[model samples]
Target: MDLNSSSPQTIPVVSTFSSPFDQSPPVKDPNSASTRKPISLWPGMYHSPVTTALWEARSKIFEGLLDPPKDAPPQSELLTKTPSQSRTTILYNFSSDYILREQYRDPWNEVRIGKLLEDLDALAGTISVKHCSDDDSTTRPLLLVTASVDKIVLKKPISVDIDLKIVGAVIWVGRSSIEIQLDVIQPAKEESDDSEPVALTANFIFVARDSKTGKAAPVNRLSPETELEKFLFEEAEGRSNLRKRKRVGDRKEFENGEVNQLEALLAEGRIFCDMPALADRDSILLKDTCLENSLICQPQQRNIHGRIFGGFLMHRAFELAFSTAYTFAGLVPCFLEVDHVDFLRPVDVGDFLRFKSCVLYTELENPDQPLINVEVAAHVTRPEIRSSEVSNTFYFTFTLRPEAKATRNGFKIRKVVPATEEEARRILDRMDADA
Candidate 1:
């Protein structure tokens, strides 16, 4: 069971690993020399021609998302164009490079939410390849990815030679998705601090593909021009119609007396915030509030189409849900949003994964912020029959740092209970179907 164990914990050998819902007989790892290959949908977005001539030598940093019409655009709207000749805003900045600030320093140099989700997944794949090459800046080059990330708050703690910036734009476009919006600012570290907040914001989505049939293609269309880009194009068209009503079943599934109405609202103490009468039910038991990690899926953590890289499994489930919400809220949480992640399968290259995390609920929202949701999951092992598999499932959200008598008034944390009653009606049907 030594699938190249790099140790972050690792223990599941469960007999000899192999069942993420069986592909029937495929677990032989005589110390795997990496050959289980078959699921690598080539997303090598560009493995050099000097990285496609340094992306056509940054065609003017994608002329603000392709304003390319100095003539030629007519073979029947050549893959549809408009949105004022393709939306805009892209800005970047980044500074602190010395092998990226010594690989995210730790003897105190800051910058590590797993190197800020691998630099916000390479700045949301360079704003989805400059908004899918501003709708074909002369064709052939799509292969985008990261098809889901709708949230990523972070709001502070970047340090290490500061700079950053980022920005991005494309609000929502669909017909092969796009979304974008990200933010990530930095600046004001004090020129007598004239405000510049927003240490991160995120909303990504990206899809495009088809660089020789990986499929889904077409893009370009977010027109909105101010009034805050039409209120972020109507909040990215209501989160792209709530991600097409949770992808087509038009949403609605939490029944079975939704955890008997969350155990009659936690046996009548009617929880909805202000809790601390030493919040009970054996102190929020989901197996006594969890947090795990394990490891062994390296190869420099795969990706560029080799799997296991959704921002390095979202930086190992946001550093184990910020170490189980900093050991159940003794403070230091921050990073809010990533309210969903569903990769669901693909973590191979010597699998062993694991992750786990917990605390599935907590809120206060104001009264000195408090939120915390977490969840995590992942799994993989399979050791013959000791079983494992699940693969992925994230759902983050945090917020704590308030200080002054520890967050002024609301947060004696510790609340996620669900340990059956169908995991308490699937955590009250996923927090009432995700709020």
Candidate 2:
């Protein structure tokens, strides 16, 4: 269903309870929070039985967004393609109870950034599927998976019970890749207020795959008619080029002599070039700042593919980064941006995922305005095979809150001292060339 023609007033919100399989309950109060359903998700299209049931249970409300509006004018045709094939937007207003969940409901009834990441991933997936489905004529929709979260900026913390709007649009398209931009919006409290506050903005890249071959599939080419759309298309194109270059460089370094060089350096007990000296370690490096978190992927966190959710993994990494940053700066660190996240492999339900995070680099030219760079690596250990594989790597940047910066005195940014030459090379490779 195309939402380009939908009207806000006539659309009935999600009425089904939060569970995946439960039927819609009778409304006692028309204006209650339970009655104001969140956005509807696509129910039955692909994936396993349990996954389908879960999606169906969670997706009943998303269809309401396609309902026609009662107060707005006709759908504009200037920005996108035809109403049926054009871009779409979904509006969701999750309640505090729904967001806080059972475990997080105790003292702090705040929404977790992990939950927001889950929603962001889902939103981007939905947009990619819809964009690809425009030209698909088969019964099965085109399958697409998230390749990477190129960049994301969380401007402010999202609280529980607030009405948040997620806007998704296709900015650029490649032969099999699509770049999606998502904006997390916080509507103004006062009706008279004209400002629409954006809490977060993200750029996600997805790859289309052939159903039978499981290989890259061609997608529809995007035509940007508007100037803003054209600009985003160019930007996405450039980012895509950079991504390709980095991947090629990494592959070459790993295949060539870089890995061996690092290993040899480690064996020789020599330090890497352009690194801080061992004598300065006491003053620059903090002793207890690094952190590690471990957890088994439960059934609840599994997505339609019976694999652990990417957003859940990202959330775990983010929490680790935040904690490490807080420990280093002795302040309430605010989320600045996610520089990059590469999903190396899918984590299974029973896999033991370990998140190792440390403050990789810090810039403290001005104590009041401190910046931190953290690197979080995810490794999954399979119990059956007694083996572990690298799963994901996340690079994050954060800043301390203004009030904390103002009152702090002894806080300092610590530099990571690589324990080995391989570790040093990893640190060097992790640095963003663009930065």
* Top candidate by TM-score: 2
TM-score of 2: 0.73
lDDT per model vs. reference: 0.58, 0.62
lDDT measured at residue 319 in model 1 versus the true structure, 0 to 100: 84
Cα lDDT, model 1, residue 352: 80
What is the lDDT for 223 in model 1? 62
Those runs of model 2 whose alpha carbons end farther than 4 Å from true positions after fitting are 1-21, 24-86, 92-111, 134-138, 156-162, 187-192, 250-278, 281-288
> What is the C-alpha lDDT profile of model 1 across 289-366, one tens digit per residue?
687879888665665555566777787788888888778777677666676565656676678878888877777545
Cα RMSD of all models vs. native, in order, equals 23.0, 9.1
TM-score of 1: 0.34
